[model samples]
Structure formats: C-alpha cells, structure tokens
Target: MKITRILNKIDRRFHPSHIYALQPDHDLLRENRTYREAKDIVLLSYPRSGNTWLRRLLANSILEAQQYPSSIQSDIPFETVVPSIYTQSIKPPCLHRYDEVCHRIVKSHEHRDARKHKTVYLFRNPVDTLVSWHHFVSNSPSLLQQFPWVVDLSIDEFCLNAVDGWAKHIQQTRHYKDILLVEYEHLFQYPHQMLANILDFCRIPRSNIDLDQIIDNQSIRKLKSVTHSQELRKGGVGHGEVELRPSTVTELRQYQQMLNVAWKPQVERSLMTAM
Candidate 1:
C-alpha cells in the first residue's frame, strides 16, 4: 500500500495536466505575469468553454474596426491580438493598427487573478463543458505527446475530477464590480446581440466595424479553412446530456446546485434551469 501510494504521488507530481491546475495566490502573479499585466479587459473561462472562439471573434472585429488592410487582418493570430497566458509568457508587441482595447484584451482559463482586471466571464452548462473539455484534453497533440495518460481517462473519471473547477471559477469572479457574464449558449442563440454586448462592455466602438462581416469572417467553417485549427469543435449546445454518463450528470447537477446557492438572487440566470 505504501509503495502504491508513493507511485501515485510521483505520477501526479510529473503529470502534464498540472499545467491547468489552479495555482496558489502567491505564485499566480509570478507564474502568469502576462495575465497580471493585462490592461482593462480579460476574457476568462474554464478550458473548452468557448474562450478561443470568442477571442478570435473580438480580435477580427477590432482589426476590421481599425480599417486594417484586409491582407493584414485576414489571419489574426489570436494569441498575438490578445496576450494569452497559455500561449505567450513574454508580452508580444501590440499590433499597431487596432486601438488600446485590442492591446488590453487578454485570454485566460484560470480564475484567481481575474478580479484585478475587468473581466468577461464566459460560462457554459457544466455537462456540456465537461464533455467538450474531455475531448479537447484527450485529443490535443501537445498534451498527448507529454502525457498520453489523458487519452486513457474515461469521460466519467475526467468529469468527476474536473467538476469543481467550473463552480469555483464562478465563485471567485461573480462579484467583481467590472465583470460581464456571458453564457455560451447565448452566443449561438443570439450571436449579434451577444457580440454587441461584449463590445459595449469592453468599450469598443461598434460603429466603425460591420458586425455582420466580422461574424461571417469568424464563422467556424471559415476559421477552420483559414487556420486549419483542430481546436474549433462542433460548437452548438446539448452535447453534454447526449455524451456524458448518468452518474456524471448527477455529479454535475450537484455542482450546479452549489452555483445556484452562490447566485440565488440572479434566479433567471441560474444553471439549475438553464441546463
């Protein structure tokens, strides 16, 4: 038993998945200095929760608004447009064409440091989030190269381990004075209105950019063709209920109940009914 426990400890110590694990507050600023330096706006979400899609959309729109020649704006490297903690450790030079908001928007999956910046929190139903996250982590080439163990995890095991982080993220960032809550489903159902809301929240002028053109440019089909990215998946809702196990659903619901208790006054936005 002792030897087995020691082996388990060693396995976890060297696990690549620890890259996504929440860091202690003291180490967070040092480890995620790019995130700490982000100005005005930060886009926050748990992994696989539409953060990438939204970031690309915003970046493209900003470039268009600035009237960047189509050639320059055609392939907006999202990591460059919005300094991401996951992608860039040193701050990349800000693209010159777009205004200050473009430089200020940063993307992050972790939660603890969000309160320091005005945040746009994107959340999805926990069931769908886990299902999508499982697919992303298991299939991502970079993660698999170093830690093939991820592909071996059953969906149940993955969801069970990951269930708490979603709620914990909400708990930490919900009350910040400058936060905007964006539900992922709303992006699908009401793309125009949602985009406008986010632009307004981030203080980007909507008049200069054609919202319709930006949305079309950022559509999943066009983005996939242009970037050949595997990260963009089938992005509509309800996959969680269809893909996850019954036990996993129940566990996720329990977490939803906790989320409800956390934001009971905002009953209309409750996950209990939303999911």
Candidate 2:
C-alpha cells in the first residue's frame, strides 16, 4: 500500500507523457500474461540477422498451410498490441488477438524475459552482421535521418561499439531459456529444412507455402548478395578478415585480453548456456 502510494505520487508529480513517455497503458505487468500464455513462438534475432526474410517465409508458410487468413504480419503485431514497444513499426500493419490466431509468431529485437515462452536466436558472424546492418540502415531513408551519426562512422569505428562496448545487447538475449541458435550461413544453405526444424520445435505444423516459390522470388534470391545494395555496402562473412590488418588485430586482441578476465568467463558461459 505504501509503495503504491509512492508510485502514485511519482505519477502525479510528472507529466503523464513524460512519466510513461511512449509506454503503453498497463498499470502493472504482473497481470499481463500475454507473453506467458503464448502457446506460440517469438522469432527473436539481432537486427539484420535474416529475421525479416524469416518472418516473410513464415508468413508465406502460414498462408500456404491455410491455417491463417492474413499475412504473418497480420497474425502477430506486437507494437500495436504489446506494451512499450518503441522500435520500427510495420507498414500495412499486422494486427491480431492472442486467442483468435491459429499461431502467433513475433519478430522482436527486444530483450527477452527468461521466464516467458520459446525463442529462436538467429545470428551471423559479426562482420557479416555489420555488412547487412549498414545496408539495412542506409536503405531505410527514415532511419538514415534518425541516426545520421551512423553514416559518419566507418565500419571499424562502428564495430568498436558493436564489439567493444555494449555488444551484449546484440550478443546476449540474456536469460530466455528456450532459444534455438541458428547461424545465417545455415539458413541460406538450407532454408526449408532449417525452417522445418524451427517449426517442428515450436509445435507448428509444416507449411504448404511453396517452399520453391518463396525461395525463387528474385528479391529473396538476391538478398544473399550484400553487393545488391552498393550504396549501403557489400561486406561479407569475412569482411573483417581483411579489415583487421596486423596492427589492428594486435591492438584489438589486447582489448579482448582485457575482457578475458576472471569474471568474463562466467558471464560468457552463462550467456551461451541460455542461448
């Protein structure tokens, strides 16, 4: 009761927009069991780890299976329904109710609750990730406007943040226990069979989405080539391989040496175990 009064006082003291600012209207997440009751799946991944394409494929599958009436985008729209989701929004927005959809699969780059439902963590080698990310951010003119500094920094400078500092945001999905780590190479190499493993694990049935049709689409086919977007860049699996000149690698190796202290091992072990 005292805590509630204090919280209320804090709420009353600040501007509602500031107090909640971009937050959804949920008094207490304690009662929000949507993510908990999810008999479905959360398609979790770092930005540009083929999550968009995966979601597309999943949407096509659901459509083909005839299990759903709308696109996968419609089947699960988290920003619209979930509380405090403040990333990018979907155009021709997806919308749904938990009980109504046959299965709801969410694509989120957000942090996960270790206590909640299943997760699929898709990743790529960091160099490849940076390459794809450069294209992704540059191509979206709006994002380009929002984050102008991204353009100012070269890949090496940018990676200092991705690798040097807050790298955990991308690397660790933190404590979600049911993560299935899928590397980008394997996904490209075996889209159908890999997707099958994901579906089967989630208990979703195999989809009738023409495995060939979706794969055959030219855009989908071309996604493999980072060069496809030259203005953005065309870095690949081992781009960093070349970028790390002998001196750079030596200096960078020291940074890792510093990071490889007593506490770091335990932390990495814990993160990998969760993944």
Candidate 3:
C-alpha cells in the first residue's frame, strides 16, 4: 500500500503510463467513510470565490508550522498540500500521514451529506461571485461552447441563476456538523485578524513568524508571481456594485440579507471569538 501510494504520487506528478494510476481512487473516502475522530478540514467555496487564494495561504501556514524541509516546501505544489477532490486523487503519499505533524486541507466546491468533516465555508458576495464567474466561464472556450446561452445572458439573468446556485450551496453546507463561515470581503478588510481566526479554526498555530508576516508573504501578487496563475482576478470588494444593474444588485443584496439572517449566529460567534 505504501508503494502504491508512492506510485500514485509519481503518476500524478509525471503522468507517465509506466507508473500506476490510482486516480479516481475512493480509498480515502472509503477509509474515512465512517464517522471518526480527527476529521479533515475542508475549505469549501463556490467557483471563483477566492478558494485558491485561501488555499495557498493555508498551505503556506501549515508547511511552515510543520517544519517541512524548505526544499520540499518551496517546490511542493499547492495541490500537494491542499488538494481538490474534483481533480486530484486522494491516495497520494503526501496524504497518507494524518497527525499534528501533517494536517489535511482539502478544497471542495460541492457539499455531501453524511460526512463528519469540519468545514470552512468561504462566502463571497454573490453579486461579485456572479460577475467573476461570468468572466471565468466566458473566457473558457469549452465552457462557452457547451453553454452557448451563457454568453448571451445579460448580467441580470446571470445574477438570477448564480444567486439560486449560491443559495442551494449555502443551504446544503449549512447543516455540516462543524462549520466556520469566512467572508471574502472580511478577509481583505481584516486580513490579519481573519487569517488568525481561520488558522485557529483549522488548529494551525503560527510558526515563529508573526501573523502579519504570513499575510504579507502570501499576497495575491506574490502567489501569482510564484505560480504564474491567471485564475486570480481583481480581488477586493464592490465589483458587483460597479458592474451590475441597480435592480440586479438589489435582488442579490436581498438574497445576501436572507443568508446573513440564516447564518447570523454562526457569523457573530466567529467574529466574537476571532479577536
């Protein structure tokens, strides 16, 4: 099994046919299928909602605190540390260890029932999410071709559709046994404090480095420079207000208000404890 896990890692790394491919492997899911202690932390969000950015931040913090060799730390891909279940196999060698020395951070865009994992739900303003998602899908030739109507939809129409999806996701994930709500806007506004809350939620203590230093080192610009990733767009607040029609903005805000009402207690509790 150890050899198989190693092979799986190599297969994913090099994608050579000679190596064994264990992708689509449900071993981890099946192994952790039953409810147990030490549940993995899931970083949950909708697409284009700052999942990658937050993942990078979490991964950096974990690696530093765990005292992983600087060589591996420097070269290890983000997915190697915080993998996406949608794309990466779960049976990689890096994931075999489960302890304080090696914490698991998984990225997920979907929710499943009957799981006992702790979740950190990244909530972005739906209006901003709608605009960002539109640009994201529109830019992809495959997505545009598959959903031709997507290109034709007005911002209002897109917002209507996007809001429904957001509501459904929120409704689905709200019932998780353990959940932490981290607002995208608040992360930027109160980065140092918000990051501390997130680390504490995930049980990741800061290394000798200060919290402000961690935030400074993991800026979007630095991450982009390191990974050369184009997925990160203009990250801040008020994109929806700037681009969407007043009516559309009003509708999204109404839905946002409803969500706020639903999760107000959790949000308030997290805020109070964050300090």
Taking all chains together, each candidate's TM-score versus the true structure is 0.77, 0.56, 0.78
**Against the unseen true structure, what C-alpha lDDT does each candidate score?**
0.66, 0.48, 0.66
Off by over 4 Å in 1: 1-17, 20-38, 69-73, 89-97, 101-103, 141-152, 264-275
lDDT (10s digit) by residue, model 3, range 81-156 = 7776655545546453434644577776656522577888998888888788777766767555545666666767
Where does candidate 2 stray beyond 4 Å?
1-37, 67-102, 112-115, 138-151, 165-167, 207-210, 222-275
* Clashes found in each candidate (C-alpha, N, C closer than 3 A): 0, 0, 0
Candidate 2 residue pairs in clash (backbone atoms < 3 Å): none
TM-score of 1: 0.77
Clashing residue pairs in candidate 3, if any? Answer: none
lDDT score of model 1?
0.66
TM-score ranking, high to low: 3, 1, 2
User: How well does candidate 1 score on lDDT at residue 234?
Assistant: 64
The RMSD (Cα, Å) of candidate 2 is 10.9
What's the true lDDT of residue 137 in model 1? 67
